[model samples]
Target: MVTLNLVIPCFNEQEVLPETTRRLLTLLDGLVANGAVDASSGIMYVDDGSHDCTWALIEAFHSRDPRVHGIKLSRNHGHQNALLAGLLSVEGDVLISLDADLQDDLAAIPRMMAEFRNGAEIVFGVRHRRDSDSFFKRVSARSYYRLLRRFGVNVLQDHADFRLMSRRVIEELRGFREVNLFLRGIVPLLGFRTAIVKYDRHARFAGESKYPLVKMIMLASDGVASFSTKPLQWSAYVGGVLALASLSFGIWALSIRLLTDRTVPGWASTVIPMYFLGGLQLLFLGVIGGYIAKIYAETKQRPRFIIERTL
Candidate 1:
């Protein structure tokens, strides 16, 4: 039987850690008992510089059960980096990543393992439905995935970071050294034989969501900018279209002055086009600037995360 490791990233998850620990250990026990995974299988928790007793609770779990492991980052490096840290650090034949909250159903674990045994190297735990989410969240999330697809990002819809990767897949993933990580996009690019196990998402067991609206927007921006230059290309296309429109307007104005009896209002015509073109210029510049910022970040080659301690 292959050793299975669950890599969960935590930030201020003190409220849910106890129950999360209990449920996961029980699940692992069941897997081991059924011979689905080796008895040596375990869980690794990455503490993303949470200020609460999150690390201490992890230590407590580790003391009580050798199956529990912990990796504390030097600082909060966001969820994607923290998850990456755990995946790279853990030792197992297969690795499954999920959130600290119980939102990602544990029930899908066995189904994913079955898929893996059936020759799937990457088993994505896709949400079957988002009935637990608010209406705005459901709409926005659907739109976000659709937007990524439009920008040519090959991502599995309703699949977040909750998925299984074989050792070879994780090893290949390590070769990707970009500092601005959007794993949701990067994983799909790995081109492995993949499978999907659908499960209903539950509400957060406890604590506030780590991803607020602002962070979600930033993640979407990163997903778009990292995978495709479509935004930058669109900016150029817009500029070209505007230029043609401006030339056509100039010709129309000149013709009115020369051949037509109707007089064009000089200030209104000039100022309106000027304002419109100016706004478009600023908008495209902002898009270009976003790409430049990503370039600047990638050049520094800073370590994505630092492990302050591990247990």
Candidate 2:
């Protein structure tokens, strides 16, 4: 049997640690006994600079159970970086990443491992349905995935960070060094044989969601910027269309004044065009600036994350 490691990123999740640990430990024991995974397999909790007793709980769990390990970041590095930190923390045959809230069904582990054993290098634990999500969340998530697909970005719909990746996959992933890392988009680009294990997304066991609307929007923007330059191309398309319209308008205006003694009203024409074109120019500039900023960040060559301690 091959070893398995669970890398969970926790951000101020003190309330859910006890239950999450209990369930994971029980599941680990069952998997070992059933020969699905080796006895040396363990769970690693990544403490993403939690300002609560989250690290304390993890240390306690580590003392109680040797299978439980922890990594404390020097500061909060967001979920994606923290997940990456966990993935690089240990050497194992199979690694799985899941959120600390336990929203990803833990019951899907056996099937995911089964798929991995059957020669699939990556197993994505996809959400078969999201009935528990709010209507706004459902709509926004659908739109996000569809928009990425339209831009030719390969990402699995209804799949978050819950998935299994082989050791080779992790090694290849380490070579991808980018300031704004989008694992969902990057993983699919690796061209591995992957399988999907469908499971229902459950409500958080405790505490509120870490990702609010603003964060979600920022994440979507990062994903788009990391994967495709379609947004920048769209700006050029808009500029071309705007230029054509302006030329046609100028011709009509000149003809009206030459053929008749009437002039296009100054405010009715100039004022509206001024505001509309100005707005479009700034919006397009912002899109261009986003890519430039990403380039700026990469040129800095700063460390992706800082680890304070580990166990």
Could you give candidate 2's per-residue lDDT for residues 1-311 as a string of tens digits? 79999999999999999999999999999999999999999999999999999999999999999999999999999999999999987779999999999999999999999999899999998999878888999999999999999988999999999999999999999889997988999888887899999999888999989999999999999999999999999999999999899899889989998999988875878778778989999999999999999999999988778899999
Give the least accurate 10-residue stretch of model 2, judged by summed lDDT.
265-274
State the lDDT at 281 in candidate 2: 96
Model 1 per-residue lDDT at 42: 98
Span of 10 residues, lowest total lDDT, candidate 1? 260-269
Model 2, runs deviating above 4 Å: none
Question: How many backbone clashes does every candidate have?
Answer: 0, 0
lDDT of each: 0.95, 0.93
For lDDT, the strongest prediction is: 1
